[model samples]
Target chain A: MVDIISQGINLPLPLLMLLLGGLTSLMVGLLSERIGVAKLREVWMIIVSAATLTSIYYLNQSVQKAGVLVISIWGQLPPLGGCFEIDTLSIFMSGSIAVLGFLVALYSISYMEKESRLTEFYTLMTFMMAGMTGVVMAGDMFTLFVFWELMGLSSYVLVAFLKSKWGPIEAGFKYLVMSATAGAFLILSMAIIYGMTGTLNFAAIADNLRGAAVSPWIIALFSTLVVGFGVKSAIVPLHTWLPDAHPEAPSPISALLSGIVIETGLYALARVLFLTFDPGMFKLPIAFLAVLTMTLANVMALLQTDIKRLLAYSSIAQVGYMLIGLAAGTTYGFMALFLHIFNHSMMKGMAFLASGSIVHETGTRDISSLRGIGKMMPVTSLSLFIALLGLGGVPGTNGFISKYHLFSAAFGSGLGWLGIMGVLNSALSMAYYIRIMQVLLGSPKEGFKANEAPILMLTVTMAMAAIIVILGIWPAPLINFATSASQSLVEGLSTYIGAVLG
Target chain B: MVPLEPFLVSVGLMFVIGLYSLMVKRDMVRILIGVEILFNSANLCFIALSTQVPGFVDPYAHSIVMMAIVLDGTVIAVGLAMVMNVYKHYKTIDIRKLRRLKW
Candidate 1:
């Protein structure tokens, strides 16, 4: 038999890592019945994370060294079986997803100690991880939709995993309905695109649609895609499910959802819009969403009493900031957007996990009741503090680097107003971060005693915080990778088209 | 000839009705049914659109619609499972009553 990958590339291993996660999930229920599922989950998650990281790293190296690798099953062409386009962008995203997944999985071992359904939790989470990897790497629209559903399905289950609680079940239902509606629009778009271009492959669709005349229906197609994807990404008007869904899930899962789920939606949107339509026509609408999503989410964040809810709103706002870069439609703007995606993932993951440790120890998520909890749980509080600074775009945190570039890139790309709005929003966001700190460290509340979280959780949070600071100061490497990715996207459909069709 | 207008018109009307019920329904079960209706409408679009192409049926659209149905079924199954859990906790699946996770 001939080798399957067209470009002599190795089998797309990141996808393998993801699929393995889903495959292994079937065994988790049975296995957990016999052994300590939590501990077993930790081991399994570590292995999955290692594979993910190794796969992503090798994928990145290959893209950087060789070229964009298109891997299809059984050597089938694009129109036949689904294809995976391993490029700088996909690998960059998978790298963050894998790394955060490892840390969150590690932290969840300790955090979810008292929670029931260990195997189910880990299984859904792994399935979710696999789904994300698939979405990022998917070269065909149908493949992306498949993985998108995989991601959405697992998240719905994970959100409601704590089924006994009324809050989780309620939130999970709302999330399911909203996301399912979004899924409907997604398929609706796919059906129309199939009807229009008579192809489903991303690159092939791009080639066909670009040559076709721009009709009114094309706008409808784009609008449906935006609405479908925007709901998943939680862009402004469609973002109601996010705050509820993010806060109701297990903290580690919340970290994953907040950190990467919405971001992946945006990623898919960018990829599809770039592949199929004339992107210049769409930049203004994207910029409009960017402004609206950021400003509203930040204002909401300032009003939250629950720490996790606060972070959740803040996550939506950060998506707004990332969109500013995306809307700029410049090479640097795109690079900055990807960079912030990675940076925000680390910062938000750390924040959610650190807060999880606090909630784990103190049995509360209210910032008011948890006065001086920072003193009680020193490491976690500190991590939360650093994560907050990163979130607020403090000078020495990783967030600063991305946000700074984002604003500059916006202005450079002639969206000076967007840059100004971003700065104002970042400034507006700082108020809540300060309030969190005051609650965490300002004064001691009587009769509230909580110790530090477990060693495992502590190690993970601190490691992420340290990374935030390090990346903040020395972001050269990430910036380099992001620029290359952006360069490829900005260069347009030629390279991507050639790779897929051959 | 499978006259395309009627199929498109019916699918469009059903989609609107499903979305309307989905938005307006207060009961969770009703909401789930609304979702199912929307999904079936989408499936109808898929199948109906396939008929427009000349000659034989489009296998890709058929396969895609089938996959979509399976995926849609999975979503509703989970939705129903969640509905069961909701009823277990609150003794009702009324969407208006479940006000726990707001804001």
Candidate 2:
């Protein structure tokens, strides 16, 4: 083990963090029930989260030493074997996921203690985190698909954690149906690509794509891939399952679902689109899809009464913004997309955590029932307000910076219509966000009383809120990171192709 | 004209049957069976593809298909567990009544 660690190809520290967390959580879960010790579960969760956060910090530092780290597991070569490749792009995502994951774990301590299946909940959460991290760091198609399924399966189980609740069970069922169909489409696409190119590694596919003639079959493969990932990313038409699934999930899991997991799907989409096919194949359809996704999601979000459902719709809308960035097929576009990925994770994670606190205290998730909650749960309400504003792309918030860059990238790419649609959606999202605030701050309704969330939850919310503000104001390092990560994606293609085919 | 071999015709027929059952089946248990049939059809297709590739059965695709079968088995097992839970909760196997998410 020591030799492996010392001689290891430069692995991103975040991946190790997630692996350790998942393993520890699984061990603790198995033992905690047998030993009849409850506190040990909490202790294990905290230790796992801390270790993940520390590893993320170390990963950020290592980014300076290595432009990007590409590591293979079990010394496996690509195309025929699975591998993990860490670049600046993946490291940035892993870091953001770790930060939010740590806070959510802390929040879950107070939020989930009263529940009977606490150990199971923590174990699934850790596994889900590890899966997401794996998806981002995956070096090849097979690895990405395997980790994608891991993330999807864990989330399906988590969505129905409240087994007795009809809402959660039905939501989980719908999610499973949609998710399984998507997984099948993904498998079919992979098989076709392998049949055509005789290799499963992404880099090999790209090389074959350049010299190989485009056939109708290739188009079918790409379309199938779009549908598969589109469902996970909650693109317009494919987004029906999300509004139900996100809200039905526990709030911490909702944070993960909305914040990191969906974005990981989009990240994979972008990586595949940019790496596997020429820019010409993607230009028209992706831009058109971006426009449709943005417009449709914002329109649907306007009608939602449930706060979590509204946010879920907004999550789809945000994915559209990232799609617009990626469709540009430029370094600036990749930068904008990744920047939004980080910012959205922080802002949405805070929002979901705050929503959890609200539900914890009020025992309801309806926007109307949450009326005057600002006066009762002042801290939670304030953090939520900040999150909403950030989500709406208000100035001095991280959302604003990322959205601004995305809009600029769209315009630079000459897709002014997409830029306009994105701006319009941002304005439209504000309407629902502000309405929720109004309800939260308004007069108390009959049978309503003041209550606050637990201190641990409050601390987690405040920490995320602060990071959102800080990153918004001082975004130079993040901007640099995003730019470099985008460069790595665009510049490393030839090397990747050569490495695989040679 | 392309020759329609009996084995190829049977594979196609099995695929259509499996797809039809998957779409028409109301019972969760039946749906799992349909999925199993689809898996077998796909396995048949894999064998066909391997034969077309000349010498040895393309070990790469063969291994991938094997892995996929294992994965499908696990997924079906989980689906069965979920079906058990549904039976305990709603006391029925029909999917039409599971309408908690409808707008």
Candidate 3:
């Protein structure tokens, strides 16, 4: 069984594909440059990301059959050395990453064709996806941190890729400073965990530390963990960089960052908090942060003039909503959480891509200046309208389906007030979504001219829009997958530990 | 056994110093240095905690610290590159001067 899984692949299949693809693409990039071949790197990226998706499908089959597949690095067993433990949850999360990456790679071909530095852009983007994949599949704290840094490093460069402008440079620096600080706190948290448990493995740490009585060390660990993960996730107080950074990055990257990258941070937070403490222990504090995150980000999002920045703030507010599921701390709640993660990735990712098409055509991100864009670019504007409605949780959209499940899960867990706050915030967020919609649908301003976006970008946005609508209507399959994913994390604890310890 | 109090106190002090510099420093390069200090403080905490075990030091913490230091160096390298770009654009490394992107 082991040999079958390991045949010609030492690491997890998705991670190996991504890492190898990222490395070889660097060479491909240089060769393309020397050979005067254009669009070669873009083609390589598209194949790599698509292959990553296929590998995840294969890995998912193995995970389902084995229940948990533990792959130790350097031939060292777990609880002592670094490893990757893939359960249903890892497959689900990495599947989301690869899906978004594949779509973004396709969209970037048309979107970034005019930009220079194609090599660095495609390579760093691939590494960034590879990093997120490793992070989700990581079995130990050190492995997670290493991949976390890899993700962080690649994103910092990608955020700053267009250095000809001051906006990206400044945003990238601020992002780097804050994220590097978070990385430091993550190390400190690891040290404290080691001090408490004498091992860095997730299963070992969970074995030793979960349900331990409240102590100063536990309190310190909790705060450090929050600080470490919160900045990247853009939890309210640590979120200043996001509004700037997300908008300043190139549009496709903006889509990826606001779409899945922040959710990856929230995913790490959920995984660690669940492993180290009982759900009852951290529920209230996380709940409180959820309220703060939602209220503040919604209010800020309402005030934004720039379309992408507004979407960035809305992303934070969505993170706030995801935290409600975490705070509820039920299997049902976790299912809701992961459900919302996938749904939001599609909705927000499409929203950004659609807006990116708008920006590419009109050369502006200001919402007012985009008046009558719907008239000029009917297909792009139509997709954007669908994306906006999905994000606002309108009925018959996937966002509403996941959000309905999320709020009910909160109420089911006796967090009725949180559910109420979530509903109110959902209502409040619609104001901005409608604002964008109105801008798109309004009569055209004089002298405004834009043709429909290129066929590739339009197809990607329309595909995501179709997904949002189709899943909204027939959500049973996705809901079932999310339920299994959450069950692995919340109820399959024993199986996960046994896979690691034995 | 070696006492852990002094090492813990030093780590705490370094942390505070690093955060203070991060908050107060105007120079972008100094801010990056502050981040490096914070990283080193965490590395020191790991090393110190690894020593608390009697009769033998855990090699795991040493290995992690080695990897972490390299990671920190790369992060700072990226930060310095960003700082250079900031200088080219704003003609100053003062972070406050790069405030064209306010809310």
Q: In terms of TM-score, how similar is model 1 to the real structure?
A: 0.96
Worst 10 residues of 2 chain A by lDDT: A1-10
- Model 2: CA > 4 A from native: A1-17, A33-37, A57-68, A498-502, B1-24, B32-47
Can you write out model 2's per-residue Cα lDDT over A1-502, one digit (the tens) per residue?
0011113444446666666767777678778888888678878877887887787677656654655444556555555665665666777777777777888888888898788877778878887888888888787777788778888878889998998877887787768766766776676677667767776777677877754557887787779789889999988888889999999999999999999999999999998878777766787789888888888888888888888888998898899889988888888988999999989999998898899888888788888777888888999999999999999999999999999999999999888988898898889889988898898789887778967888899999999999889988999988998888788788766654554444
Q: What are the per-residue Cα lDDT tens digits for candidate 2 across B1-103?
A: 2222554567668767866876787887887777667666655655555555645557877777787777667666666767777888899979877776764
Off-target runs (Cα >4 Å) in candidate 3 are A1-9
Residue A269 lDDT (model 1): 87
Error of 2 at A192 (Å): 0.8
User: What lDDT would candidate 2 get against the real structure?
Assistant: 0.80
Candidate 3 has an lDDT of: 0.94
| Candidate 1: tens digits of C-alpha lDDT, residues A315-383 | 999999998877887788889999999999999999999998888888888889999887789889999
lDDT of the structure predicted as candidate 1: 0.86
Native A-B contact fraction in model 2:
0.10
- TM-score of model 1's chain A: 0.96
Q: Candidates 1 and 2: which is better by TM-score?
A: 1
Which of the two, 1 or 2, has more lDDT?
1
Candidate 1 residues lying further than 4 Å off, grouped into runs, are A1-11, A25-29, A35-38, A211-214, B1-3
**What TM-score goes with each of the models?**
0.96, 0.92, 0.99
Compute the lDDT of residue A431 as modeled in candidate 2. Answer: 90
* Local distance difference test values of all predictions, in order: 0.86, 0.80, 0.94
